[model samples]
Target: MKCVGLCPAFVVELWGVLEGLCCVRRLGFTKVELNTDSEAVGQLVKEGRVTSLLGNTLAKQRKLLEFDWIIDISHTYCEVNKCVDGLANFL
Candidate 1:
C-alpha cells in the first residue's frame, strides 16, 4: 500500500496504523495508492519536518492504465421558529 498525498489530517489520523508506514517513497510503489497535487508533502520535506522518500510523476500514458474513482455530495438544512406570548421559540 502507498499513500501519495500530503494531507496532514489524513496523515495524523492514520498515525499508529500499519498503513501509515507505506507512504510514497522514491517513485516506485508496491501497490496502488492515492495522491494529490497540493505540494504539502514536498513543503514538509523542505522544512525538515518530514524525512521520507518521494515518488516521481507517472507519465500521461500511464494514467490511462489506472482506474479512477470519484465521489460527490449534496447537503441541505432546515429550521423553524414559533412565537409564544411575548417569547420567541425555535424548533
Candidate 2:
C-alpha cells in the first residue's frame, strides 16, 4: 500500500488498480482477477464512463486491458477483503 496524500477516493482506488496491473504484468501473469472494494471505480471501469476527472487513469487502465492477457475486474465488499482493509487501516 502507498500513501497518496490527499485526493478523491476514486482516484486512489483506480491508481491502486493500475499499479497492481503493472506489477502483475511485470511478474508475467497471463490471467488476473482484480477485486476492488470501490463500487464507483468498478462502475466506471465496467460502464466505460470516462469523466474529465478520471479520463487519463481510466485510459491507462483500458490500455493495460488491451494487452495479451485475461483480466477480470469486479467489485467485492470491503468485508470480503478484510486483509487489505486491515492493511490500509494500519497505514
Candidate 3:
C-alpha cells in the first residue's frame, strides 16, 4: 500500500508490507490486507485503473519504490563522482 510520509523509515516499512502482499499472492492467495492510510487509498481510487485492493496496493508500492535502494545508491554515487571530478580539475 502507498503510505504518505516524508520519513525514510516509514516509507521502507510500507515498502516491506507491499512486498509481503506480493509474496502472498505468488503463493496462490487471492487476497491481502493493506494496512495503510486513507490518503494512499484515495490516490489509488483516483487513478481509476486499480480495481482490486491488492492490485492497487502493489501498484502504489511499485510506484513509490520505482527507484529502489540500488538505483538510489547508483544515482548518489554518480553525483558524488562528478563532484569529485570537478574538485580534481580545480586542484
Candidate 4:
C-alpha cells in the first residue's frame, strides 16, 4: 500500500482498485473478485462507461480486465467493507 496524497474520493477509490488489480497480477493470481463500496466507480466499471475525470484511468483498468484472467467487479455496502477500512486506517 502507498500514500497517494490528496485527491478526490472517487479517484482514490479507483486508484485502489487499480492497485489491487496490479497486485493480484503481480502475485500470479489469474482470478479475482474486486469489491468496492463506491457505487459510481463500480457502476462505471461494470458498464464500461467513462467520465472526463476518469477516462484515461478507466481505460487502463479496462485493459487490465482484458488480460487472460477472470475478474468480477461488484459493489457492496460500506458496512460490509469494514475490513478494508480497517486495513486502510492501519496503513
* lDDT, candidate 4, 16-88, per-residue tens: 8888888999999998999998988888777777788789878888888889999988888878789887887
Question: Regarding TM-score, does 1 or 3 come out ahead?
Answer: 3
TM per candidate comes to 0.19, 0.88, 0.31, 0.86
Model 3 quality (TM-score): 0.31
Model 4 regions lying over 4 Å from their true place: none
lDDT of each: 0.28, 0.86, 0.44, 0.86
Model 4, global lDDT: 0.86
Candidate 4 differs from the real structure by a C-alpha RMSD in angstroms, to one decimal, of 1.5
What TM-score should be assigned to candidate 4? 0.86
Off by over 4 Å in 1: 2-36, 50-91
What is candidate 2's lDDT per residue for 13-90, written digit by digit as tens?
A: 989988999899999999999999998888777676678877988888888888999988899998988998898788
Output the worst ten-in-a-row residue range by lDDT, candidate 2: 42-51
The clash count for each model shown is: 2, 0, 0, 0
Pairs in clash, predicted candidate 4: none
Please identify which of the two predictions, 1 or 3, would achieve the higher lDDT against the true structure.
Answer: 3
> Cα miss at 9, model 3 (Å)?
1.6
